[model samples]
Target: MSNKPTCRWWPLAMLGAILAVVVLTWFFDGLKPELRLDMRSLPPGAGHWLGTDTLGRDVWLSILAGSQRSILVSIGAALIGGSIGVGFGSVAAFFGNDRLRFTLRAYLAALLLLVVFVYSIAVLWPTVSSTGHVSVGISILLALIAFVAIFWLLLRRFNLLRSRITFPLDTITQRFIEVISVIPRLYLIVAFAMIIPINMFTLIVLFAVTSWDVMARMVRAEMLKVREMTYIESARIIGLSESKVFFRHALPNAIGPVATQVCFTISGLLIAEATLSFIGVGVSPETVSWGSIIHGYLENLQAWWLAVFPGICIYLTVISLHALGNDLDRMCHSKH
Candidate 1:
């Protein structure tokens, strides 16, 4: 018999365990108040497997409740940020004039660099809870500028189309894209306006602003390259309107890179969250993340299990995402 341990089953096994933890936590959270952890009556005995935390609350329950926070933050941040980044980048790719595109590239590069610097500084002196309002404000502002830059680029593209030729409903469709683009961008601005002082939500906002551009830039580059392909050129030569060539031929091909970027981006964001939490700049102490969990165990290094569990979670998340991106890249190439 092969010595190999059916490694393929590992991911499924881990996922199953994670799912079980979630379900069990949900069940326990809904338990009768009296049935919950009663520190006075409990010890490291048969009933309590993991033992109680400092506050006499069940460590297991705390972990479960905290997972809800962590997952929600990650999902919310990814959706908000990913949408802005993808939508903005697509507009820039499809419609921008050379000048607008160049300007946008320069600005985004600068902003990304600035964010990197900020992240480094934040990492050096981590806090239990960062300035959520400030982080949210900065993120929203960055998103707005990025979105506007992208919209301007798309507008220029539409103008180019208008100068060359038009399609059926080109005017209406162009106008609609232009208008809808502005709406999402505006939401970013409004998000800044309605800022609350919640660290978890603010961190999500931060992640959304900083992360999406990488995906957007990748998508934009793919679109630019695809637009110059033989099919696109032929379409243009045959007097096909710009929108038709962009939407029908170019955009679809560009989606592969975008999808791959998003997969990677999600993984990156999770790591970023952990990093932020580790340094004390991410979620509040009230919440639990791999980073915060590790932070709690930092001094208590002897308690290896405390750090081990969270570290594993972080590593697995990153690895899974990297694997997902690689698979998507292969699939995309195979299709092409």
Candidate 2:
């Protein structure tokens, strides 16, 4: 009833509507020829909302399907990489023996070296067929293995925190906080690795890797600050182990900023993916991302609608994500 205009609802409302349109288009992508792209496809009138593409495919359908893939891949990358980063980061913060820190750093560096080596191979040979599938699978496996190894190290460190029975619950809670920290850079790195693979899965990983760095750094910074809090000091004084105090007392509180990052990450990754695709480094030409769509009609400057509509779609989606992140941040801080 307060007349303060609930900005919170706006993003949800817009997202819902966009999602609905995407669903409709996906469901009818092949059914109705409402926006089919053939020359016989008539101009926008009562029937077609966005007109047609060069192949007479419904512009709306193409946009919907393409957006779906982009969103799914981004979210997937965020979740996967984010979780891995958080686990290892939290462990390092909690029971961080100099040995453990050195070990993890060494492990991460080794992974980076391997990825670089593989990337060199990809750049040099660059197959354009099902080989992309193998490349993408290898990249994903490498990313996952690296993440898991780091997380395992973190888990082992957390076990040190658990020795203090007075705060056993706290040590377990570290996992969530740690995961959020790794999301930004880890996702970004995954996305970058995916870029050269020329496969759908690789494209998703590329976006993931490029986007997760910010989240991981944000989480780590928050944990660092939280580790110095009064309760944390008290927990240590009361004989609560370092791991317990670090995971239980500090982690939950640090999750506040993670939501905001998620919103920005989504929008940013979309633009990044499109840009990559435009440069011919993202998904293959057969893929229907907004970037590919734009590339398809780059020479046909007169028929600008092909590129215009997809660009608009990207803009709208990004704006909606940004607005949502802002609203979520407000909601989170308001609670604090």
Candidate 3:
């Protein structure tokens, strides 16, 4: 009755386009690296809509393949990272005693520091060696195991020190978060890429590990507020187990902000992956990605289609995710 027109189909259309791209790439997997030396670097024409790359591979097909990989990395990282953050944060906020909280905080801090140190060593190890006999990738893997062993020993030392001193867990956690927040995230990711393997699975895991802190902080802040609500107190008064009250009541209410954070996080991760690929640190040389496509033809002035087409896809995907996140945030706030 009002003058407003419904555009409910728009979101569906966007989703359908994304799914179509993914599905088509899978269906046409044979075209992934098919070379056409006869048509190398040709501009857009009837035979090749988006033209061919320097290697004579179809630009359009490459974009489609890249999208599938990027989407998989983003979605995989978001789901696993979000779950880990939510679980750890909700439990920390609602269930732990002072000693338990201290131990958790200490462990998280140690793990973060250990990862940074090991990654640094792995990145620089190759340069330090006089002989080129050692493989950087193998060094990183061995360093990972060594670092874990070192962390175990350090954890034991910290546990002993923890018993001798008592500190506010909240204050310690806040300080640690602030310290991490001050460091540039992109540089940190690059550092990890330099040391860690640059395959899709490892990239997904790296993103998840780096990203969980933000999710944890958001969930913890939300849980802190939700825990004081009357419903939570009532659940406790009714003799519900602490885990039951926390998981069933506190977590559900606190999850709204976390969901919004997750949406934005996915977009950021996508961009991060692309940026790393652009700089040659994201995926392996053999793997195709939007960033890799752009990087591939960057030196050729005539291969404009290679850059422009994939660049547009990257822009559209990131914008779509941001719009979705904004809508979710509004819906969540409206409910509250």
Candidate 4:
């Protein structure tokens, strides 16, 4: 028999420390991130612990405020996206017939292509309408409406396909996953942002939509493996319903990978949020976020503190999340 591997502690320690900082920052909400003309662009000193931005806002206060927003958005995106991925993936793997699986795979592929096309159109909308014949806003609105309509149609079709199961697996799903895997996610985000009016909620939605495919694929892979186990077969043999066999016997065992996927998703979403903000397309200008804070100082190279403090916060938070995910993944493997 193999000896159980001992769990590492530093990941948990780092995660705890990061959470503590975030919580502490939240409690100091009284220190509002308002402007102070007298202290504008001041270096770190007795008056401002982290210095002041060009707009005279306390850097420390901004960092705290930004951290709160970033964390909330990241957590929200991760939870929503992870839930979606797990649900869709588990259903496809366990309940899907071959025809249903093929339809779903086709839908996913079409969805990817739709995203790319929409993003491209959004990016070129302004240039294409240089003659002022078409309003950019109207173009964006139409594009968004089209995206929604297509998505709804695909969903309706998926439901219809689900009603008629033909086979257990489809190679098309794997091909769809591979196609999506090769696309540049950052470019996709930037393109989407160009067409959409970005706010915190919109950013969260964007992250959730784009990031869910990976989580779904992960869950699907795990469920496929688990469903083939002897116990699952025995449960089926004993006349357990497919739903029961899936939810009760297979799903619970497959959760470890899902949990790890969620952790990593949170980190990736946070980084995506930051990148959007850095590029001036994430949150609204009025919203306080670490990415926005860093972006504000881009014009003034000497305002190093403005960028450094928030950059550090983003770095630490993402690293902590990644470390925690690694630990969770290791624990999951050890159990197997």
Considering every candidate listed, which one attains the maximal lDDT? 4
Candidate 2 lDDT for residue 43:
40
lDDT for predicted candidate 4 compared with the true structure: 0.74
Going through the candidates in the order shown, the clash numbers are 4, 33, 0, 1
lDDT of 3 by residue, 1-336 (tens): 763333344544665697688877888767576767787788899978999887777888888888888888888899888987787677667653353434554565566666766665555443433234457755766676677667667767766434342435555555655665677767876775555445677678777866777887888888889988999999989999877887789888888877668768888988888888888886666678888888867768778887899889888787777777777677677666
**TM-score of model 4 relative to the true fold?**
0.74
Candidate 1, superposed: residue stretches over 4 Å from native: 1-28, 31-45, 96-196, 237-240, 299-301
Q: Write the per-residue lDDT of candidate 1 for residues 65-173, one digit (tens) a residue.
A: 5555555566677778768766766656666543122344344444666665565335421332344355755665567567656755765666532333222232333
lDDT of residue 90 for candidate 2: 54
- Candidate 3, residue 216: the lDDT equals 75
User: How would you encode candidate 4's per-residue C-alpha lDDT over 161-188 as one tens digit per residue?
Assistant: 4433244443545565566667776787
Candidate 1 weakest lDDT stretch, 10 residues? 161-170
Q: Predict model 3's lDDT versus the native.
A: 0.74
Candidate 4 residue pairs in backbone clash:
98-167
The window of 10 residues in a row where model 2 has the poorest summed lDDT is 161-170
TM-score of each: 0.59, 0.66, 0.75, 0.74
lDDT by residue (1-336, candidate 2, tens digit) is: 663324567678887887776566567646333333344333444555776656665666567777766666666666765665565455445443331223444444455666655654455234433354656766665785677577556756665333321222223334544554466643444444454444566666555544455665667667777777888789889997666776678778776788778778777767767766666664654566677667656645555667888898888888989998887777777776
Better candidate by lDDT, 1 or 3 = 3
Q: Evaluate residue 96 in candidate 1 and report its C-alpha lDDT on the 0 to 100 scale.
A: 56
Among all windows of ten consecutive residues in candidate 4, which has the lowest summed lDDT? 161-170
TM-score quality measure for candidate 1? 0.59
**lDDT scores of the candidates, listed in order:** 0.57, 0.62, 0.74, 0.74
- Model 3 is weakest, by summed lDDT over 10 consecutive residues, at 3-12
